[model samples]
Target: MESKKKIMSEKLPITEVNPINSRYYDYAHFTYPWHFHSQYEIIWVKESTGLCFAGDCIERFGPGTLIL
Candidate 1:
């Protein structure tokens, strides 16, 4: 079997959290598909709203919530 590789992003500073992560999607929303990774994630939304899916739970989140 051939080896497959997953794309990885560089470490970002604390000030550039939202825009850096939000760039995953474009105006049409036909960006990268749903996927999971081994690393644990924590997202912070500043002046924005969107949907979140973690494991089996799905819901809308905003600027003050923390997801695991």
Candidate 2:
């Protein structure tokens, strides 16, 4: 959110890099704490799985999943 800020790295395969909106890149994993923002968010997960927390919605997600 807030203009889509992404923290990126390259320790792993680029495809492994979680996507955030129109901007795309090849990088590593990312993490975000429980929080909120004003902008819209788009996320894609590939080759990985984890729990997602969005505005009190808590659930487990797997690869090839998209969240917004």
Candidate 3:
């Protein structure tokens, strides 16, 4: 059997007036698949606990956890 890996390319909703894209999510769990973006990204978790996977690194994150 052949295994296939897929990653999604995400485009940020940025504009001239607002060059930065920010969001606040309150969900039971993350539903997005593996993805990548051209622009720099930052994730700040205000509340929740989960495992964060970046590249080949995996770490546990919770409230006040910031990733850049």
Best-fitting candidate, measured by lDDT?
3
Model 2 Cα displacement at 18 (Å)? 22
Kindly list the per-residue Cα lDDT of model 1 for residues 1-68, writing each as its tens digit.
99876655545433434433333322333244456765456655454567887778998987687777
lDDT of 3 by residue, 1-68 (tens): 99887999888887789899877777778877899877877888888899999767899999999987
lDDT of 2 at 58: 86
Model 2, 1-68: lDDT tens digits are 46875643323222336534355655565544345655567788876777787666888888888888
Give the candidates in order of lDDT, highest first: 3, 2, 1
TM-scores of all predicted structures: 0.46, 0.53, 0.74
Overall local distance difference test of candidate 2: 0.63
Task: List ranges where model 1 is wrong by over 4 Å.
Answer: 1-32
* Better by lDDT, candidate 3 or 2: 3
TM-score, prediction 3: 0.74
Candidate 2: clashing pairs of residues: none
